[model samples]
Target: MIIISTLVFFALLLIGLDVGFSMILAALIGMVLRSGAGIDPVMAPMTLVSSVDSVALITIPMFVLAGEIMNRGGVTRRLIDWSAAMVGHFRGSLSQVSIMTNFIMSGITGSAVADATATGSILIPEMKKEGYKPGYASAVVAAGSMLGPILPPSIPMILYAVMANLSVLRLFLAGVVPAILLCAGYMVICGIIARRRDYRAREKASWGTRIKVTRASIWALMMPLLIIGGIRSGLITDTEAAGMICVYALVIGLFVYRDLKYKDLGAVFYHAGRTSAVILFLLAAAGPFAWLLSESHIATAISQAILSISTDHFTVLVVVNLLLLAVGMILEPLPALVMFVPTLLPIQAQLGIDPIHFATVVIVNLMIGMLHPPVGLLVFVTSAIGRTPIWSVAVEVLPFLGWSIVVLILISAFPGLVVWLPNLVMK
Candidate 1:
């Protein structure tokens, strides 16, 4: 049953069906085939309904809406200006700006694709004009955007929390150190490349200019801090925080920046609704698919198979990371998370791994996959935005990829990087 369902799922994917529907179809086939063996047909639809019926799930759409509003409301421009003022004096300044801006934007957007699109659109042309190679500009944007899913308010983290039965606040906290480490690593890589290539820095900005930029951008910057702080202080639930962010984004966009027009809001809502629908549908379909796996004991079988290969936790972790990396190269993060997290969650108990730490490892691996070759969504997005060839961007991203992998390995080896903040804060 497991083999056949797996084959059907891949086959549906090959034939161009939506991923959510493909998962649903595969699970339905499995359930029907096993109907006489204590698998009730009614279980499939019920699972789908129950999966998306969470109050916590409401946060996803609200966050998505806030991100969309910010994008259209000129928030990215303010972030770029602020980042440039802060980092533009460094050698390879534009590259540094790209990294820093993406880090800040990741806090607002929480979607890698949006980060790549927003930053790449603004900075890639500027970087090229300032003597940076197009491929390098695109590469920086793609690699830096990986921070989106690693930072707090992360959509992927929320999904992982829901699936793993972990606290959303704890998972969000778990990502902080790892996110900082990646940001620092990218900065180092940017500096190295800039020095080797003789990239020139912009003239140093005065304190007055820095202060002006900071003042202009502070409202844009406060969204993430407010959401995280509110949740951390137990002042609001994640869902409430998300709704507040939406309101905050609207007011800032309309009143403060005055870039968001009332009429344009219709389009923003349309886009947000569409994106939210895709995610919610994936979650709904993943329900029965995961349920079917659990019902058939396939999840346990896979976990035992890995344990038999090696009882060493480190060895199992390395193998799992490799598999997830390979999977991520081909699949987008959300669909991949829904399909694999259940299969792997059982291993946490067997290996004595903390769920939050395991989640960080898995998410980091998949986020890096966004920069990988062939089907990397961010790679394509950045390439198009920068007007660079995909191959060139692919080549340019390799060093950053290495840096990301180093961070991933460190996070895996030291679970404290992921667990320490959550443990301290949540306690």
Candidate 2:
């Protein structure tokens, strides 16, 4: 009865109900139904707040602020310039630059939406000017933006860590190799599509000019290193390191680069605050939902259902991957992670899967969700920024989606790709 009511509430949510209110109402309804059967009401929301009150959650706001600072401070632009110089010699080089720039920007921002917004705003017009179709440009930007949260210092991972009772540091480390592999995979897909379309490379700058561009981008590049290094060496926690990134962005923008002004700080703060609030509320609401999910035996039911289908670990992975992909198409990453990780973690653990690898699987799947139709936030953001039709961009995004699926399969098949770095470094 609790499960049935929960499903009904989620169905209403899917039809345009506000997620926070929908979740709270659904949980409330589920509790009422269960209480009639002699269950309790107070446990769910109490568990929800308890779930969300972790110190790790502080990273969300700091990282959001850090991303805003980097975006407004010219760091993101410099990264794009340097990435373009590095890859512009190849066929369809400009398209390749979109992927590469997202890779670099991901290290600093760690938010896929932010990456799509920042890089797409610049690259969409440039790609169109360079003869790429409007849809294609938006597609590339949307697909490439997945890099931001799949990589290290990923805000989603922080949420997943708290939700699943896993190691945040290990999850951050686990993402490194898969993130690199994901970027490479997308580059290959971009190259293939570019070659087939007879896309042309950008004008090649001289070696000296390329070197100068790299030199200019050095400060921006160093931001990732400092954050990663700080985490690896225990010099600072991820939360403090995010604050460090804000300082880095502020200094580089105001004093070093001289592009970011005092007046700009207000807008950056406002935007970051807004973004942070949405995520925090989602976290708070999911807290109760997750608690109720556990108490209602959803996690056990899922694990039992999977085992009933296949005791073989490999088969279980395949099914889980498909399930997550389908869910990703409908749900946003943070809420999805909060809700699903609790259910899935116990199942994966029973199969002896590494928690870190499972977390990567969860993230990559959610990242794909950010690009698919109807509910794909990244696709919408990219289309809006490019000022193009969403359907056109969705069509253009097809090849990249195929590319993402391929990588997803590889990561699922070989958990080592996701777990290797985290184990090597964190151990």
Point to the candidate with the largest TM-score.
Answer: 1
Instruction: Name the candidate that leads on lDDT.
Output: 1
Instruction: Give the TM-score (vs. native) of candidate 2.
Output: 0.96
* Worst-scoring 10-residue span by lDDT in model 1: 368-377
What is the TM-score of candidate 1?
A: 0.97
What RMSD value applies to candidate 1? 1.3
lDDT of 1 at 24: 91
Candidate 2 C-alpha lDDT tens digits along 247-300: 888898889888789999999999999999998888888766676777789889
Q: Each model's TM-score?
A: 0.97, 0.96
How badly does each model clash, as a count of residue pairs? 0, 2
- lDDT string for model 1 (1-427, tens) is 8689989998999899989999999999999999989898798889999988888889999999999999999999998989889999988999999999999988898889888887888889988998898999999999889899899789999998887788998988888898889888888899999999999988888999999999999998988889888998989989999999999999999999999999999999999999899989998999999999899888898899888889787788888999999998778889888888999988987788888899989999888888888678888999999878999999999999998999889988888988999999888
Clash pairs (backbone) in predicted model 2: 48-287, 48-288
